[model samples]
Structures are given as structure tokens and as C-alpha cells.
Target chain A: MSLDKEKIKHVAKLARISVDEAKVDSLTKDLNSIFKFIEQLNELNTDKVEPLTSILNQSLRSRKDEISDGKIREKILKNSPKKNEEFFVVPKVVE
Target chain B: MSNITNQSLSEILKSIKSKKISSLELTQEYIKNIENAKKLNAFVTTTFDKALENAKKFDNKPNNEQLLSGIPLAVKDLFCTENVKTTAGSNILNNFVPSYESTVTKNLWNNGAFLLGKLNCDEFAMGSSNETSFFGNVINPIGDHLVPGGSSGGSSSALAADLTPATIGTDTGGSIRQPASFTGTVGLKPTYGLCSRWGIVAFASSLDQAGPMTKTVNDCSIMLEAMSGFDDKDSTSINKKKESYSKNLKDNIKGLKIGIPKEYRVDNMPKEIDELWEKGKKILKDLGAQLIDISLPHTKYALPTYYIVAPAEASSNLARYDGVRYGYRSQKGKDLIEMYENTRSEGFGDEVKRRILIGTYVLSSGYYDAYYLKAQKVRQLIKKDFDDSFTKVDAILTPSTPSSAFKIGEKTNDPVSMYLNDIFTVPVNLAGLPALSLPAGLDKQGYPLGLQLIGKALDEQKILNIGYAFEKNCGYKNEIKKWWS
Candidate 1:
């Protein structure tokens, strides 16, 4: 269950976080120790146990699917790091 | 008037109602305390001007009937305060001011409490100690070098230091109670879904709950009553009728059955913590409550389960911070994907990055069943253990933490050691139950130790009542000598 440098890089990639080369070794070590700690869960037999998706036993409540609130486009875009007129401006996605 | 800052929330409320201390005067006193105690590094953003404005407004049109009635509170930075900086103690959100108020903070404001400031916390409410905060470590006011237990470190520190009359904090694991234990304050994590999570910076959605951190258990009850309610915005919020916890609070727990879980005695536990637990039992017994020894057999696996579940959810929740919306953006990236990678890497601190990575790994394709699913099943067993125990006893008692506050930099390098700080407190969160940490005694070094009272789901009143009775009989007073001043 120990993570190596390659696995650490792969996971970091999936998480969309870039790992520095200098930090990879220590990161790998820390992840391995944490994984080692998590491995203790394997000792419990949960074959028939149900995975707890929610603490409350009730079903998710639904609301009427209608336009509730709108016309605050400027407020929605106010916190964007980079935005223009009506939308968030990201780096060029389709070059 | 000089010692006005030293009064509890209830006492201040009484004075304000009697016209003895105006809201403006109270706010000014707290602002002065916060200014003079800046060495503790408890506050990330101080709202002294806005606080003063609100205080003046409240004083001009006083409303004594409201719950808080113009009390100023400094909440943990994890809560999103509208038009104010809500960093969650991370560099990623250093400049991000939320456009909307979180439902919890909104509730607090509606009840007549205004923001004094945003207190520092572990980044994204991720770490057990305040050391993980990007703003910097909040020194426990009890001593110069002790780490304030976190991610509610700032809330606990501010409350203990009298920077705020009372404060609120979110507990994912032990964020509220552990710090409360360390700082010798009262903290209650109400039943999961008791408080709405809308607009809070997402950590682990299921386990993250907002609760009160106050100077006394009575204050905890009053604050919790104000802070919790059904919200249409949060799907998980309980829609049950709000109970008057403060009004119904009774210090007489005679004939009530309290459980003492034998499994909480972990190996190498401090001798004083054990003595403190024994003393708590004796106090409860003397108060006419029946104490029974019970077993929550799956208690040992709670931490490991929490590590897997919390991080897995965190990775998914934090994926929202892709540099497209708000928060820190890296200048190094050339393309969209690279921009996200660089932004997350540079924006988040190391501990946050570590949790995100662990979350991403466990929820990844090949490992999902072995780690994430398995942990969820273990989580069910953990919850069931509490359910089984609650059927036999009204509430359970345990030590709030394994030890008192540790010195800063002592366990920073070892993540596992740091995770152990929440051992006693994490189980309550997993079961979606309510628990309160009451400052019962101090360690040999004069560091505060707390005893926890665990209750069934939505049973905050019972635990708070027990805590009230314990507070009356325990004879423990926090002798925090304003060393920072």
C-alpha cells in the first residue's frame, strides 16, 4: 500500500496539483505512512455491512424545479480571479 | 467597566439588557482586547470598523429581546462572511471576499450578534493543530509556545483570550472540542445537520458541523440555540422544531444513566487525563446520575476511517478551486489544465495538498473499493456502536483529547501523531451525534484537560445539561493569566 514517487505523481496529476520534483520524495514518504495507517481498516470484516452514504435515514428532499432567483450575473462574477462582462475568463481552453 | 471583557455571554447580555453596558461600549472593550493581544496571532482579519459601526447601530436602536442582542463575536475564518475576507486560513482565498453570507453566520447576525473579526484556523479546517494555518500559528493564550488546538484554534484562542465574548467553530473531527479542551473553554458539536453548511468553504461535507465555543457550558447552550435551525438551502439540515436549549437546560441529571466507554482508554494515556476522567465520573455520580461501563467496540478504527472518508470527500469538494472562479491563480501556467495544477499546488498549503492527494488516491479507480468503500462500511460500524450504546445509557463520558495542548513544532513532521489528537472526539462526529467538551481540570503543567459528554443524535440538550451540572460541581476554573498582554 506504500506510494512510490511515480504513484505520487500520478495521484497528484489526478488531483490537478503539480508536485515539485524536490518534494516528491518526502511526499511519497508521508503518503506511505498515512496509507500504512489506513491499512488498519482492512482488519475489520464488513462483507455484509452497508456503506454509509448519509447519516440521516431519510431520502433527499426535492424542491420545485423552477427559476428561483436570477438577474445577479454581476454579483456572481464579482469574486472571479479573472472575469469579463458576464462570464469567468479562464486560460484558452480551445486553441 | 474595565473587567467587562471578562464576563460571559450571558452576563454581557444581562448588562446590555439592564442598560449597564451599551453594545457600543462592549464592542469597544473587545476591540481593545484584540488590539492589545495581537501577539497571540489569533485573528486573521479584524473587522473593528465594521464591528464598531454595527455596534453603534445596535446601540442607537437597542433590541434586548433578541438572543444575542448586539453581542460581537469573532468566528473562525472558515465561515464565509459576506463582503468580508473569508480565507479559511489558506493562501488560495487570501483575496477572496464572499459575495453571500453563509447560512450559519447569517443566522448569528440575525440573532443580533455582529462580526468582531474573522479568526484564524487550520487551512480549510484540515489540521488538528493551528500550525497548518497559512495565516500563521495561533499561540494558545495559556502559554507562550503552546499550539492552540485547531482547526477552530482561532475561535478557541479568541474566546479563551476574551477577544470575543463567545465564538463559533466548525468541527469536522475535533476542530471545536479539541481546541476547546486545550484552551479551557466550552465547545459543543451539535448533531450533524443541526446547523446548515451553506456557503461554508467545503472541507468534508458530511462531517463538517458548526457549533459554539464559549467560556461556559451555559453560553454554549445559548449560542447553539441561536446558531442551529432548518435551512432550505442545505438539504441535510434537520427540519425538526428548534428546542429551547437555554430555557430547558436543567443542571439536575438525577436518575439519568451515563455511559463510561471502556474502550476510550487508549494505551499510554496520560495519568492525569485518566484521573480527570475518574473525577468526572465521581462528580456525575455525586450528582445522582447512574454511571454504567459500556463498550463502543469499533472505537479504535474511527481515526483510520475518518482519514479515508474526510480526504476522499475533500478532494472532490476542493476540485471547485480550479483557478477559474475565485481564489489564487498561478502565473506560471500556459494552458487551462496547467493553470489548475499550478494554482492548486501554489495556492494550497502542504497539509491541505497532502489531504487532497490522499483523497484523490483513495477515490481513484483501482483503490476505491479497498479504501473509500471499506472506510464507509467501517463508518457504519462506528455509528452502530454508538447507537447500540445509547440504547443502554442516556449519554457517554470520555476524555476530550488524549493529552493537553502540545508545544508548537513538536508533531508537525509526523502527520499520524497529529491525527491522534482527535481520537476521543472523532467518534462523535462519525455517529452524527452531539458532544460537548467541558474544561474539567488541568494537567501537571497547568495545561487544561477536558471531559466530553457524548449524546444521541439531536440530543444536545441532554449533554449540555449534564455539562452544566458537571460545571457546577467540578470546581475547575481556568486560571489563564493574560500572559500575552
Candidate 2:
């Protein structure tokens, strides 16, 4: 259950977070310590248990697809780091 | 008038209603306290002008219908205040102002409560101590160099130091109760879905719940009543009528069965905690409660399972914080992918990044079943253990935290040691039950010790009653000297 630097880097990539190479050594150590502690859960037998995603067992409620919220596009765009009159400004992806 | 901040919430409300003291005057007094208590760092943002304006407006209208009319209270920064900056104590959201109000804050305002300001908390409500806050660690009001237990450290510290008459904080894994324990205030984490999670900064969606941190158990009940209700916006919001928790706080535990979970006795538990537990049992027994020994067999696995599930969900939830939409964006990126990576790297704190990495690893391609799915199943078993125990007992009693508040930087270097602070409180969240921590007594070092009472789902009244009874007999008052000033 130990995590190495490569695994930690892959996880950081999957999570879209960049880890500095200098800190990755310490990060790997921290993650491995936590994993070592968490590995104790493997001893428990949970063969018949259902995965409980939420405490409330109710199913997701469905409704007609309509615009219930979000008419103020200005308000929605207000928090964006970079926004034009109507669109968010991001680095060119397709280019 | 000078000692107005020392009055209880009920007293403040009564004075406001009786016109003996105006809401404007009371709000001004609280503003002064917030200004004087700058050294504690309890408040992240103080809405003094807004609070005074609201106070003036309430003074003119004289609304008897509003329960909290003109009461100035601090809110944990985790909840989105419509125009105020709600950072959740993270640099990633340093300037994000939510367009909409969270249902919980809206409910408080509707009941005539005015904001003292947004309080500090753990970054995204992730850590146990306030050390993880991006602003700075909140110093404990009770002792010098002592850490106020968190992620609701600001909430508890403000309430304990009388910076605000009352405050609100969210608890995922003892975020509310543990700080309340450390500061000797009362914190209640209501049944999951009892309070809508509509506008809260998501931590672990399933585990996160909003509750009250107040000076007394009675105020906790009043605050919980005002802040909770079913909302259409949140799919998980319970649709039941809200209970009259404040009214049901009379001293009554006659014929009720209170379970003392045997599994809570971990090795090397502090002497004072054990003594406090015995004292709690004695008080309940003296008040005609039937004490029974119970077992939640999967208790030991709660913290490990919580780490797995919470971080997994957090990794997914935090993916929404890329560079494009909102929050802090790094300028050192050539492309969108690098933009996101660099932005997140610069924005989030160390603990947050660590959780994200752990979360990513557990949910990554090869390890999902062994970690994520297994934790979910283990979560269910944890829930079943509570369910089985509840069928036999009316409520469960345990120490809120394993020990009293620790000094800052004592356990910061080791994540596992810090995670141990939530040992008693995390299980209640995993089970989606209501639990409250009230100051029981002071330890040998004069730090406050807290005892927790856990109730069945949607059964907040019973635990409120239990907490009220314990609070009355415990004789613990969160009266600290004005050291911060």
C-alpha cells in the first residue's frame, strides 16, 4: 500500500494539481504514512455490505428539465478570473 | 450597557423585545468586541457597517415575529454570503463573492439575525485544527499558544470569547464539535440533510452538515431551529417539518436509555476524559436515565474510512476550481492544462493538496475498488453499527474529543496524529446522526472538557434535551478573561 514518487505524480496529474519535484519526496512520505494507517481497514470483512454513498437511502428525485435557476448571466460571470462581455477568457486549447 | 456582550442569547433577545436595550446598541457593543479582539484572529471579515445598518433598520421596524431580530452573529466563512467574500479560509477562493445566498444564511437573515461577519475556518473545512486556514491560525481564547480546535475554530473561539453572542459552523468530521470542545462552547452537528447543503462550500457532500456553535445548549437549539429546513434546491434536503427544539429543552431524561459505547475507550485515553465520561454517566443516571453499555463494532475503522471517502469526493468537487471560472489563477501556464495545474498548485494550501492527492490516488484507475469502494462499504457497516445500537438505546454518550485542545504546531507535522482529534465525532457524521458537545468541566490544566450526546437521525430534540440536562449540572461557563483585548 506504499505510494512512490511516480504514483504520487500520477495522482497529482489526475487531480490536476502540480507538485514540485523538491516537495514530492516529502509528499510521497506523507501519503505513504497516511496510506499505512489507512491500510488497517483492509482487515475488516465487508463482503455483504452495500456501498453507502449517502446517509439518506432515498433515490435521486427527478423533475422536468427546465431552467429553474441561472438567468443572470452577468452574476454568473462576475466571479470568473477573466471574462469578456459574454464569454470566459481561457488559454487557447484548440490552437 | 458595557457588559452587554456577556449576556446570553436569550437574554439579549428578551431585552431587545422588551425595549430595555435597543438592537442597535447591542450590535454596536458586539462591533466593539470584534474590533478589540483582533489578536485572536477569530473573525476573517467583520460586517460592522452592514450589521449596524441592519440593526438600525430592525430598531425602526420593531418586529416581534423574528426570533433573532437584531442579534449580531458570526458565520463560518464556509457558507456563501450573497455579497460578502466567502473564502472558506482558502486562498483559492480569496475573492469569490457568491451571487446567491445559501439557504442556511438566508434562513438566519429571515429570522432577523444580522451578520457580525464571516468567521475563519479550515481551508474548505478540511482540517481538524485552524492551522490550515489560509488567513492564519486562530488562537484559542482560553489559553496562550493553545490551538482552538477546528475547522470551526473561528466559530468556537468567537462564541467562547464573547466576540459574538452566537455563531454557525459546519461539521464534516467534528469541525463544529471538536472546536466547541476545545473552547468550552456548545456545538451541535444536526442529522445529515436536516440542514440544506445548497450553498455550503463542498467538502465531502455526504458527510458535511451545518450546525450551531453557541454559549449554551439552549442557544444551540434556538440557532438550529432557525437555520434548518427542507429546500427544493438541495435534492438531499429532508422534507419533514422542523421540530421545536428550543421548547423541548426542559430537564427531562426520565426512563430514557442512554448508551455508553464501550468501543470509544481507546488506548492511552486521558484521565480527565474518562473522569468526564463517568461524570456524564452519573449525571444522567441521577436524572433517572437508564445507562446501558453498547457496542458499535466498526467504530475503530471510522477515521480510516472517512479519510478515504472524504478525499475521494473532495478531489471530484475541487475539480470545479480550475483557472477559467473563478478564484486564484496562476500566471505561469502556457496552456489550459498547465493553467489548471499551476493555479491549483499556487492556490490550495498544503493540507488541501495532500487530501486531493490522496483522494486522486484512491479513486485512480487501479485502486478504486480496494480503497474507494471498500471505504463506502465500510461506511455502510459503520452506519449499521449505529442503527443496531439505536434500536436498543435512546442516545449515545461519549467524550467529544480524545483530549483537550493541544498547542499549535504540536501535531501539525504529522497528519495522522491530527486526524485522531476527530475520533469520537467522525462516527456520528458517518452514521448521519445528530450529536452535540457541551462543556462538562475543566481539566487539570483548566482547559474545558466536553461530553458528546449522539441521537438518532432526525431526532435532534432528544439530544438537545440530554445536552441541556448535562449542561445545567456540569456548571461549566465559557467565561474567559478579556485577554484578547
Candidate 3:
């Protein structure tokens, strides 16, 4: 299946990536090639294969599980673009 | 120790303790080398001033006996260093500076390690060849013409170029091993969750692991000792009591059952690489390690499985970046959504955008089960192959990459060919096991060949020991590549 402009837009939106209209056709072709390769995996009989999450069969080791992030507000906020009184500010959303 | 190129952490620390070398000098030297180097392209953003500032504190610290004290170490661009231009090798976050530090880098900094700089990487750690980085591709330090194996290309090149004593690299699909093999340095992708992923820009969260890339196995051990531990912030971080990753170094390799996976030794293999594998096996056998033939039949499907799973996760994780939040905002926008689209479109390079599209498509609701779920199931089969073999052998061995490093532009136009670079290394990642690449020997053309050792989950020490032992014997006439300079 080929990727139409609409589908490209859809996928781009899902990924939060903005796509330029100029190269939509090229992206469609390359993505189709990749999908075609992925489609080859369907030929194998994976009916018996079990889905694995972590490679280790062992359970995660338990922890004390306490909230202990040492407060470093100044250090933590050093990277924020716009912060006001311990919170990040963004464009107003709700009407 | 003056060069810091091939020096071990212990030696560097000793030099520092004796006042023969100061931390500032080490940090400055690496910065100078990085600036002077022609084409290693190892660093993305440098913290030269901060590194020098931090180095001053090393003078007052107690004799804590930390492995990394006063040593200069590079960090992959994917890992966040607070207030540094912590790009994930993508332009979407080109302006993004992390408010906090990655646990591994934080730990490294805490142990008095000088942060040399941020190394270049594949955009969001997606590509194995370093071609996809928003910053121009990283070149192999050993030879400017070759592709520095990546997405940890910068890390390997940094160590290979002697830019830093060691650097931290994350491996999702052989990012570390492939580059290490290409550049003739040591790289490790420790067992999943051995190092915390918090503040490390996520790629495939399940498969991604932060590891060490150094000039030698011992240096890797020293850096690994500093990096691995449990962090409560990252849900996947293992809570196990930390073991000294260096304890197994220089440990005995006698009677160690090493498995040669028959599946990895299939046809279509390059002849020189095949000969190198045979040579690697012989070397191990001579070192008193027992070689056992084993099978991992599901190897062929590993790349496809990895591609699907990694991108699927990547699609979700990367969705956080948009113009609305604290990233690059598009100047021309009729609306917020258009701003996001234009900003991201302008920010990400062609390769980055390509994978983002592919990733989003596979994980989209209608296709999730067909692509992602099936890939996860196949991931299990691949893991089972490793698990079944581990029972018969203490450690498994294979060719790290199908062949030695290819030319820079060889696979750039062909995405499929680039993905195959990680063919041998991806399987172990899917299985979440600790694996390392040792510079086994040289090929006919004087290029390096690597032998990968896969150990049991959390068994980093054993692999370190085996690597340390084998490295001592490679009779490496010249460890440093003459062409590097």
C-alpha cells in the first residue's frame, strides 16, 4: 500500500513531526519501501511465538519505594524556557 | 597519562592523586584535542567552561577512591546534562536544554569525572551509522573517510581519537557496539535497566541502555563501574545492590564455556570477516576458554523485529516535542498546530523525519497489532534463542557486525543497508543481555575486526573479565590507528 498525502499527514501528526508538502511524494515512496520490507515478516509462522517485554525472565528487584527527589528547584529549573514561581508557563489553552 | 588516549581510569586517577596531573589540565587537553581533530565530529555541544569549573572542585574532594575521579569523560548527546545544549541529535530540541542530568552522567559528575563535552549521535539515537544526526554525520576517527559506527559514533570516535578518556553511550540497536567495532574501541551495552534511563533522551525505552565506550576494556570497566546502579526515578532501573563492574576484570578465563552461534556464522558473510571470526574462536580456545557450537536460528528476523519495535516506541516517545512546549517554535504560524508542523519540519533533518514518519505509521492504531505486537512476539523468539544457548555456554560469541566499517556514503542513500549494520548486534539487545565488542584482530586491509561477547542478564563482570583477558592476548601490534592523526 502506498502512502497518500493524507496518510503522510496523519502519521506526521501522530509523531508530532511536521511534514512539508513539497516532499510528500518522496516520503511516501521511501516509507512504502520500508513497509514492504516489514511486510516480509508476515510470511513467518509466528503463531507460537510469545510476546516478550523485558529480555530477563527475572522479576524486578524490590526497592524502598519512597518519594525522595532531593529538592533542587533552582538546578531543575535551569533548563526551562519560561518558568514563573516554580511552574512552567505555556500559551493559554482553554477558552 | 598525559595523552589520556589509552590510559585507564586507575592510571589517570593515580596521576591526579599524585599531583602529577590536575583535573583542569585533563579537561583542557581533551577540549583542545577535540577542537584540533579534523573529522572525528565527536562532540555536538561542549561544556568546556563548566568542565573546567568542575575540575577545580576535584582538588578539594577527599581521597574517596572513585574510579573516575578527575578523569575527562564524554557524554553522548542523547543524555541530558543540565543547562547544556542536550540535543537528542535532533533539531526539534536543538534549543532544548535539560533542567536535570541523566542519572548515569550525574553519577559520573558526582564521582568527580570531568564532563569533557557532549558527543554527536544519531538523531534521537535512531540510526546505527550516525548518518541521521541533525548535526552533520560523525566521521570515524581512525580514518576520516569511513562512517564512524553509530548512533554512538561520536562516543567511539571520541575515545578512538583520544578526545576523552572514556565516554558514555547508549545502545538501542547496536549503536555502541557497531561504532566501537568500526572505530577500534571498547563498547558495552549492559543488561537492560542496569543503567537508569531517566534524563537519557529515550529512543526505544525497553531496549535502550547507557554504556561505556573507551579505548580499552579496562577503561570500559572503570566507566561502567561508575554508571550502573538503581535509580528510583526510572521505573525500569533495576534495584539490585550494585556490584563492582571492575571486579571481574583480569579475572581468570580458564574453562569458561564460550559459545559460537552457528546461526551468526551463516553464508552471505564477507570472507575476511568469516576468517576473523574463526581467528577469534581460535584465540579464545587458546586462552583456555572452551568453545561450544550453538544455534540462534531466529537471528535473521532480529533486524526487522528491532526496527518495528524501536520505531514504534520512538514514535510515541518523540511525540512530546512540539512548538507548544519548551522547544523550538516556528516563527511563521497561522495556528498552533501549523506552528508545530512547521517547526518540526524545519527542525528535523530528512533522515530524522523519515524515521519519525515510519515510526508513527507502524504504531498507529489500525496497524499496531499487525506491526508492533507481531514484532514484540518475534522479539521473544529472538530472546529465547539467546536464552536457550546461554544454558549450554557460559558466554556466547559472535561477529559484532557482518563486516568492518563501510565507507561514509556507502549506505547513506540506502536505509535498509544502513539498518543491516546492526544485524549481529541487535539480537542481544532484543534479549536485554549484557554484550561487548573486543577489538579481536585486523582484517587483510588493516581494518579492525571485533568479537562480541554476550553474557547472562546482569552478568557484566564475567563479560568484562573475558574481554580483559582476550584483549591482553590480541598481540595488538598497534592499538591506535595511525591514520587517526
TM-score of chain B of each: 0.99, 0.99, 0.96
lDDT of 1 by residue, A14-88 (tens): 999999999998888888999899899989999999999999877779999999899988877888899989889
Residues B297-338 of candidate 3: C-alpha lDDT, one tens digit per residue: 888888888879887787677777665556666676666666
Residue-level lDDT of model 1, residues B383-428, one tens digit each, is 9999999899999999999999999999999999999999999988
C-alpha TM-scores of all predictions: 0.99, 0.99, 0.93
Best by lDDT: 1
DockQ of every candidate structure: 0.89, 0.87, 0.49
- List ranges where model 2 is wrong by over 4 Å: none
The DockQ for candidate 1, computed on C-alphas, is 0.89
lDDT-based ranking: 1, 2, 3
Q: lDDT tens string, model 2, B1-485?
A: 68878878888888899898998999888888888889899888888899899889999998977768778888999999989999999999999999889999999999999888999999999888899999999999999789899999999888888889988999999999999999988999999999999999999998999999988888888899999999989999988887778877788889999999999999999988999999999999999999999999999999999999989989889989997888999998899999999999999999999999888889988899999999999999999999999999999999999999999999999999999999999999999999999899999999998999999999899999888888788777766888878
**Clashing residue pairs found in predicted model 2:** none
Better of 1 and 3 by TM-score: 1
Cα lDDT listed for each candidate: 0.93, 0.91, 0.80
TM-score of chain A of each: 0.94, 0.89, 0.83
* By TM-score: ranked, best first: 1, 2, 3
